[model samples]
Target: MWDDWARTAQPLKGKVAIVTGAGRGCGRAIAQGLAAAGASVCCAARSKSEIAETVALIEEEGGVAMAFAADVTDLQSVTAMTHATIAAYSGLDLMVLSHGVALAVGPVETTDPVDWQRTIDVNLIGSYYCIRTAVAPMKARGAGKIIVVGSGQGHNGTASTSAYAASKAGTWALTRSVAAELIGYNISVNELLPGNVRTQLYEDTFGQVISATPAGGEPISSKRSHEWLKAPEDIVPLALFMACQPDIGPTAQSFSLMRRV
Candidate 1:
């Protein structure tokens, strides 16, 4: 059954997608997934070098993609990136909010004020700016898809990571609100809460913490017999499913990816 769906699910052909934070990590995976499904992807990120690399990879694989550098936390930069995507693609069918920063793990009482502010600025405020800038074009076209990359921590609580968790929780709410408001215009909005994907960002932060502890002492992976962690590629299929099947009735919801028990 799933094989049949995959063979027939090329619904996004000729569509245009904008993936923020596409320089690396899960963003790169999402961009490539969309491109593989026949969408022209606009890869947006703060680092021009990494974004270019992502674009190059996509093009090498016979996919259509272009790189654009923008600081999503800055409103003007977000606007410029959106406009550039529209000008190039002539239309925008999808917007994926995947840009975020994860500060060092620390208790709420000990976290620096600046770091907390930066978390909110990039994770929450930046997502809002991207969605706001993309809405105008999507509304004009009367159809679109918006997927916000949230975290499992957002649904529950994780010790010593209040800022990241809170930012992601806000993203969940933002997704719900946008879905409620945009459904009238035929735009679908949703949130994807990834459990633990092996991306550069995840490896740099959580990998170090996990490595320092013994197998039995690790938080999430402590009980797992297999030491392997899921990769960004594993999460991209669900993202592509959501993006291409926007007409599905699962808007305003959050889905998590985790190994089966």
Candidate 2:
């Protein structure tokens, strides 16, 4: 179903977009979704190979996209990426703040403060930097869409996920603040929690599939774990919907595609 859209749709025709962490997983899938919708996309990540892979997939489906290397944690890096996008695609229309880093599950006291801070640096600070830089060009154009990829963890606390949860919670609030700042200017900002994407990162970090969740006993740590859970591809449509920046309201809103079905 998704592959078909990649070749036929043009809903975002001529729009320019930037998707961070696009080298793989959900980021890559969202990048594909944007390109499939006819947006000229710039895929950004720390890995050149992964970014290239994403670009290749888009090209294979006859979509327009390019890869860029940038560390989302650094302001200068993100700034340069935005400027580069302007040079290539003229302007920015959509920005998907999807890059994230996870901390291992352990006792809060056992966690190094440095590790906790690093997680915040990637999941929260990085998002702030990208949002800050992307907004300028977007504001100048008097129109833009910003989608912050939040987590269910943000809504409530869970054991062993303090850093991830806290950071995402911060991101969700930040989205509201940013939306308030730009809503009157015609730009729309919103949050979308892609409920439960089954990406390789989850598999690797958890060492099991979605079934192995904290509440679920004895996780099925195998390829089957990858099956029952929603894949990155499943979240594409919602991300695309957010990309369109639907006018259900003024801005600074939040949406979710929590169900795999």
Across 1-261, the per-residue lDDT of candidate 2 in tens digits comes to 755764576778989999999999899989998888899999999999999999999999888898899998899999999999999999998899889987644446767788789989999999999999988898787789988889877885456667878998999899999888887777888888886678876766555224225554434243233333678888888787677655434477778765322
Q: Residue 17 of candidate 2: its Cα lDDT?
A: 94
Which lDDT tens digits does candidate 1 get at residues 183-211? 88888999987677777778675754454
Clashes of each: 0, 0
Name model 2 segments beyond 4 Å from true: 2-6, 208-228, 246-250, 259-261
Candidate 1 wrongly placed segments (more than 4 Å): 1-9, 207-228, 246-248, 259-261
Give the whole-model CA lDDT for all candidates, comma-separated: 0.82, 0.82
Q: Which ten residues in a row have the lowest lDDT in candidate 1?
A: 209-218
Q: Which residue pairs clash in candidate 1?
A: none
Error of 1 at 59 (Å): 0.8
Give Cα distance to truth, residue 175, candidate 1, Å: 0.5
Best by TM-score: 1
